[model samples]
Target: MSEFDQHFPLFSFPPSKVPRLLNPLVLAYIGDAIYDTYIRTYLVSLPHHKPNHLHHEATKYVSAKAQAHFLKLWLPHLSEEEQDMVRRGRNAKSATIPKNANVLDYRHSTAFECLIGYLYYKQQHKRLSQLLKMIIDYKENEH
Candidate 1:
């Protein structure tokens, strides 16, 4: 178990329970936190920058536009099951809409978050790392 797992036992639910117990939006909710944490932690690990600069840099990666772009580029690489989860998330209706993103981008972002949530809940850390690395690589290639 990771250090956080030891500290927050309540968050460590069995992977098998995920499908039966949680809806897509709930998964995306958890996913939003996990994805944001991953982005912020990665930014902090790089060369030092002002807090505002760091936040600005993170926005380029964390926004709905970016996430939707990332998903589109990576879709062909995903397995059938992963694609299915993405489809489920994209189809889920949400009461709230993001101020900065269009409906299509928002749906894609939700799908991306659902995939992350599935990986995280299943404790597939290695797969999660691979996918995150792909995102980082995409960022690097963009510039």
Candidate 2:
């Protein structure tokens, strides 16, 4: 078990049970929260504690455009099965689109969130951490 599991001790269903049971959008729903929490924690660790600055900086990472950009960059690194999960999410028809995000970016962002949710529920903690680290590294390098 990794340090995260030791500290957090979240209960995860078996991988075999997850994709078969949950809708892609449902996965994206939880994934959004999970990613948001990770981003918030990361920002706070960097000492961006002021509320307004924290929220503004978070939008740099958590916005749909940003997520979609990261997803595109990471796609070539994903496994075939992982890619399929993204495909399912990208094709999912949501009831509404955010006024700020374009359709393509929103779909791709959903795909990214779906992958994160899948990895989380499947308890692929190490892999999830690796992917999350890649995002951090990529963003940091963009300076």
Candidate 3:
């Protein structure tokens, strides 16, 4: 078990019951929350602690454009099955898009979030951590 699994002990759905059965958008919903929490936790661990500063900093990583960028970087590295999940997410239509976000970026971001949610529900915590860590490392090196 990964260190994160040991510490957090997620009550994931049975592997046979979810992911395939759930809607891609539903997966994106949970994935969005999970990703946001991870980003918030990482920011809190840094020198900045003020709520406003943290929120601003978080937007850099959590925005649709940023997520789409990360997804593009990750595509070549993903397994075929993982890529399928991303495809499902990217193709899933939504009723609304944020005014500030490009449609393509928004779709890609949903794809990214869907992958995150799939991993989470499937209890692939180690892989999830690895993928999320890649984003953190990439962002840290960007400055």
Candidate 4:
């Protein structure tokens, strides 16, 4: 295991070996949880807030619609390889759709999740942090 695997403990298997072999949808599967954890942890670390209020705040960042928006905003800034990963994810076939999100948003969110999974698997934590911070900072500055 690499140093990251020791510290973060993202998976049972090695990240380098799996990312290239896993399907985009499979990557998104893990990515959804990873992204949710990040958002929840961030919210919990903020100043004291009620559980109900925190859940609501977390939804703002974790929802499919919100993820789609973030993906759209960040797409142009991604490298060519990153863009290809997003495309693979966006075009991936999924059997189910969420009741709350439209098809477009769902696909975009999957792509976003795939991007997150890719970064995580590749151990590109710095790039992932920068991308996530860019989105959060932009949203904060907007309102």
Candidate 5:
């Protein structure tokens, strides 16, 4: 968290490590940052790519439509427990949508991120990596 984040607490975790009701929207918020970082990392690892090329590649995968598509691909693979988490995140009520995203698209993206966050919180690194690889694979195959 940076100074701006500290000053503006858009979402704050409850006092408990695990709240009675996990907020999927909050999970999505965190996942949004994580996802961007992951995409940038992937782009940076590629040799001989210009900054513009990397940005385009990252944008293609991170767009609302792409994230929603990935949600469909990954949702079936989650364990029962993770499915519950995803459900909570998906059904979470939220007041705002991203400026660039429509309501349906934004909600779907949030749901997908919530699933990723849930997996990460559970320390299911292998599972998360596998799911992410599927998403990346789709992006690669698109080219």
Candidate 6:
């Protein structure tokens, strides 16, 4: 019933080759959008929150620093394939950095986005939600 349902592949794979994934970039791409959606949704869910307030709050959580924090939390739970995905995304060449963020932070943020994108595109909605929840929980508990 979600957009993710429409976008991601919803098929079971053969038992033999189900280690991780062949296309890491795909994950990154989808993960980026998925992550943004969650952040925006989270902000919009707040009661009486104006657009500017929502944008500011979401920005804090979606920043490179915040994503880097998530990567640290996510690192321990990843398989070799997932790690490779992160690495590829983190190290990917980009034409620009985020508005006020540094180069290194931007790369890490992009990698995190890519990972979310990958999982969403793969139709691993459960897995995708699990990671996003961690980010939300961490942020919620931080304050």
Candidate No. with top lDDT: 3
Q: Runs in model 6 with CA error above 4 Å?
A: 1-27
Candidate 3 yields a Cα-based lDDT of 0.89
Model 6: how far residue 96 lies from native, Å: 1.7
Per TM-score, the best of the predicted structures is 3
- What is the per-residue lDDT of model 6 for residues 67-140, given as tens digits with 9 covering 90 to 100? 88789889988878667778988888877676788888888887888777666555568777677777778888
TM-score winner between candidates 5 and 6: 5
TM-score of each: 0.87, 0.90, 0.91, 0.88, 0.79, 0.78
* Candidate 5 residue pairs that clash: none
Taking the tens digit of each residue's C-alpha lDDT, what string does model 3 give over 91-139? 9999999999999999999999999999898778998888888888899
Shift in Å, residue 74, candidate 2: 1.0
Candidate 2: RMSD over Cα atoms?
2.4
Cα TM-score of candidate 6 = 0.78
Per-residue lDDT of model 2, residues 33-103, tens digit only: 87898888788889558999999999999999999999998898999978998999999999999999999
CA error at residue 30 for candidate 2, angstroms:
0.8
Task: Assess candidate 6 and give its lDDT.
Answer: 0.71
List model 1 lDDT by residue over 3-41, tens digit each. 333322336565556552567787788878888888887
Q: List the residue pairs that clash in candidate 4.
A: none
lDDT for every model? Answer: 0.81, 0.86, 0.89, 0.83, 0.71, 0.71
Residue 23, candidate 5: alpha-carbon lDDT:
69
Cα deviation of 90, candidate 4, in Å: 0.5
Candidate 2 runs further than 4 Å off = 1-17
